[model samples]
Target: MAERILIVDDEPGILHALQRLLRHGLSAPDGSRYQVDECANGALALEQARRHVYALAISDYRMPEMNGVDFLTALRTLQPDCERIILSGYADLNALVRAVNEAGIARFIAKPWADFELLSAVRQVLQVRDLVIENRRLADLVRLQQGQISAQEAELRRLERLEPGITHVNWADDGSFILEDPGDVKL
Candidate 1:
């Protein structure tokens, strides 16, 4: 599946640059492919995210209506699976900490981030999201297998009563098995 990425920033230049950089090397979590979306502000970003599933979201921390942290925090409640990244020129350690703890941000990038560096960070966040989803799928599979095993175990217990000395039971049709005592038998 192609991973979906959403970029939210008020600045047109920064948004365009980042979008171009990401597109050049875009790939799925399995190294297959990627699909990306962009929004000029947090409101549109939130709207898009609600309608679709995004592997990751990158947003600027300063905007008129909503800031990155606030936007991400709202998104967290709606789509808990989506990974978040906060990019900002203002270096406020306290706000970053709150965003990380409250919104579950995957990474934080400064506004004047290197092109390659930004791409690398985005890649890492997407990779982590993929791993998390994969892990959940595997866990569900394990639980399903466990349920089957439990059912088989119950069947085995019922078979044991019918054939005490038999190690296995094969029934062509649903019928009860009768075992004769060893000493009392007609030759």
Candidate 2:
């Protein structure tokens, strides 16, 4: 499946350009294309986020109602795993710091961005996101397997308690079960 990306910019032109750039330039690590969704304001973006899962969110720092930090911060609460990038023309250090600290943005790109740089940022962020997701999946699998093993062990112990030595078997050199007494078996 194509990974979904959310783009939030109040300016229509910037939103269109970003959508075009991402659609044309970026692909998931597996080579599947991205599904890009755009919103002209933070409220609209948040509304969209509630409806669908997003792999990443790219937001312009300056907006009408909610700034990039606020939007991304709110997004973090809704979708904690969604990666974020903030774009801005103004280099307000405090805002950037808040973006990094509060929003946990993955990257910050200055406005009038180079196509390659933007593409690279998206690529790298997606790569890292994929890795983190895969790691969580693997961790869950391991946990599930461990639980299965524990259950199996408990069953074995219970069987052993019910019938002592029931869980143990003697093997013959010829890969057959070694009977305690040969004459005890019937044809």
User: Residue by residue across 5-42, what tens digits does model 1's lDDT show?
Assistant: 88899989988887887877777656676677889988
Q: How big is the positional error of residue 12 in model 1, measured in Å on the Cα after superposition?
A: 0.9
**Model 2 lDDT on a 0 to 1 scale:** 0.85
Model 2: per-residue Cα lDDT over 71-149, one tens digit each: 9999887777789999999999999999999999999999999999999998899889888867755665575677844
The 10 consecutive residues of candidate 1 with the worst lDDT sum are 160-169
- For each candidate in turn, give its C-alpha RMSD to the true structure in angstroms: 18.9, 19.2
Candidate 2 regions with alpha-carbon error over 4 angstroms? 148-187
* Angstrom error at residue 111, model 1: 1.5
Q: After superposition, how far is residue 29 of candidate 2 from its true place, in Å?
A: 2.7
Worst 10 residues of 2 by lDDT: 178-187
- Name model 1 segments beyond 4 Å from true: 30-32, 148-187
